[model samples]
Target: MRTWARTGSGLVLGACTAAVHLLLALPVAAALLVPALRPVAESVVCRLAGLERRRIVVLLGGTGGRAEPPPARALRYLATRIPVGLLGGAVLTLLGIGLTFAATLLFSWVTQTPWVMEREAAVVVSGLLVAYYAVPGAVLLYLALAGAGGVARWERTLLGRLLAPSREEQLTRRVEELSRTRDAIVAAVDDERRRIERDLHDGVQQRLVALGMLLGRARRHPDRAAELVAQAHDEAQRTLVELRDVSWRVYPAALDTGGLAAALESVAERAPLPVRIHCDLPVEPPATVRAAAWFVISEAVTNAAKHSGALRVDVEVAMVDGRLRATVRDDGRGGADPAAGGLAGLARRVAAADGAFTVDSPAGGPTVVTAELPCA
Candidate 1:
C-alpha cells in the first residue's frame, strides 16, 4: 500500500513538472532564434533541463550519472522534451475528467435525486456509471504511467549521450592504467633479479668456494681428509638450502602442487615467530592470484618475524566474491613503513597482479598488512 501511494505521488508530481517545462520551452525556443539572446537562452535552457533531469532521476527513479550536458545539447533536449511534456499534460487532463465524472455520479446518488426511482435500477445505473468512468480512468492511468516511464528513459538516454566521456577519452585512461601497471611489473622483476644475484654471490657462491677449498685440502692430506670431507659436505648442504630459499622467493613450488592453502601453510611453518593461519576457500583461485597471495603472505610473515619483536602473528586468507583476500597482523613494535625496501617490493609485486596492497602500523603496537587479488 505504501509503495502504491509513493508511486502514484511520483507520477502526479512528474506530470505537473512536465507540464511546467512545456510552458517554459516556448520562451527558450524563441530566445534561441535571436542572436543577441542566444547566450542567455542557452544558459536558461541548460539550468531548467538540469532541474528536470534531476527530477526525473530522483523522483521518477531513472538511471543516469550526475553529469551536466553541453549548452547546445541542453537546448536541443529542452526543445525535444516539449512534446513529451504536452503528452503528459494531456494524460493529466484525461485523469481529471474521469475523476470529475466519478465525483458527480457519487454526489447525485448521495443526494437521492428524484429520478433514482427503484433501488434495483439505481444500483444498475450506478454500475453502468462506474463502468463509464472506470474504463477510461483505468486506461488513462496506464497511459500516464507508460508516458512517465518513457520520458524518464528518454531523459536518461539523452543525458548519457551528451555528458558521458567519449570513446577516445575512455581509451586514453585505459592505456595510462596499463602503462603504469606494466612499469610496476618491470620494476618488480628487476628488483627480484637483483636480489637473486646478490643472494647467490654473497651466500651460496661463497659457500661453494669454501667447499671447493675443503675438498682440495682433503685430497692433499689423507689422514685429515675425513674431517675436511665432513666440512665440505656441511658447506654443500648449506649451499643447497640457500639455493632452495632463493627459488622459493622467486616462486613457491607448493603453490603449483598443493594450491594456495598448502603454500600459505608452508609460509606459516617457515616463519620464525609463532603464526596462526586461518584459510577458507571453496575453490582454488587462478594461478596468477595464487602466486601473488603467496608472495604477500610470505613477505609479510618474514618481515614481522625479522623486524617486529612480536610474540605472535596471525594470518587469514579467504576467497570473497571471486577475489582472494589475505591479511597478516602481528603484535609487535609497529612502525612498519611501506616505503622501506621489502614492503615497497611487496607492493610492486601485488600491483603487477592488479591487486591492492595496504600497510597499517602505528608507533606502538600491532602492524597489519593486507592484500586483495582479483581472481575473476
Candidate 2:
C-alpha cells in the first residue's frame, strides 16, 4: 500500500515536471542553436536534470550514478521523458474519472434518484445497473494503477541510461578512489610513526634516563644506596608497563595467536570503563580484514573511554554477508568528530582495507562508530 502511494505521488510529480519541460523545449532548442545562448541553455537543462536525479534518488532509492550527463545527452533525455510524464498524467486522469463515475453511480442507486445513462428518459437507478457499470470502472481503475507503475519504471530506466556514468567513467572513478586511499594510507603510517616517537620520548625513554641517573647516584653515595635502588626498581616496572602499552598499540600479538575476539577481550579488560563485547563469526576473516576490524573497534573504544566520559560501552562484531561489521557505542556526550585525529586515522585504516566507515554522534547523547570490512 505504501509502495503504491509512492508510485502515485511520483507520477503526479513527473506530470508537473513534464509540463515545465514542454514549456522550455522550444526555447531550449533555440538556445542550443545560438552559439552565445548555448551555455545558458546547458546551464538551465543541467539544473533541471539535477532536480530529476535527486527525485529518483529520494523516491526510488537509487544512487543515480556519480556523474552528470553532458548538455546534448541532457537535451535528449528531456525530449524523451516528456512523453512518459504525459502518459503518467493521462493514466492518473483516467483513474480519477473512473473513481468519480463509480461514486456517482453508487450515490444514485443508494438514494433511488432518477438518472439518465444515455439519451433515454430519466429512470430510477438499480443495483443491477450499478453492478453492470461497476465491472468496466474497476477494470479501468486497475489499468490506470498499472500504467502509473509502468511509467515510473520507464522514467527510472530513462534516467539511468542517459544520466548514469558510462563504464569507462566508472573505471576512472575507481582509479581516483584508489589513489586517494593510497595517499590516506601513507599519511596514516606517518601519523602512527610520529605517535610512537612521542610515546617513546615522553614515556619509556624518559623513565630509562631517570633510572640511569638514579643508578649513577647510588654508586657514588653508598649511605642512601638501598633507597635509590628500590626507587629504581619501581621506575623500571612502570617503564615496562608503558613499553608494553606502546607495543600493543602497534599490533596486538593476541590477534595472531587467538584471533580478533581474544584481542578485543584483552582491550575490554584493560579499558577504564565497563565494556561489553559480543563477537559472532562463523568463519575467521582474512588477516588484513581482521586487523582493520580490530583497529576500528580498538580506536573507537579508546576514544569513548578517554574523551566521551562514558560510564559504559558496548562493542558488537559479526560477519554480515561476505563482510565483517564492527560497531562500538558509548553512552556519553555525543558530538564525536570524524575529522579528529583518532577517528580520521580509523577512516584511513578502513579505506586502506577497502571497507566503509561511519560515525553517528549527535549532541548530548551516545556516539556510535561502525565499520564494515570485506572478508574477501
Clashing residue pairs, backbone N/CA/C < 3 A, model 1: none
Provide the TM-score for each candidate, comma-separated: 0.63, 0.81
lDDT of 2 by residue, 1-376 (tens): 8877777777888899999999989988899899999999998988788777777666654466324577777777888889998998999998888887777678778888766343377777798988888788778878888887788888889888888877888999999999988998898788889989998999999999999999998999999999999999999999999999989987899999999999999989989999999999998888888788887898899899999989999999998988999999999999999999889989988988888999999998699999999987
Model 1: lDDT equals 0.78
> Per-residue CA lDDT of candidate 1, range 212-255, in tens?
99999999998999999999999999999998988887898989
Error of 2 at 355 (Å): 3.0
The residue-level lDDT of candidate 1 at 143 comes to: 75
**Which portions of model 1 miss their true places by more than 4 Å?**
1-163
Worst 10-residue lDDT window, candidate 2:
59-68
Q: Compute the lDDT for candidate 2.
A: 0.86
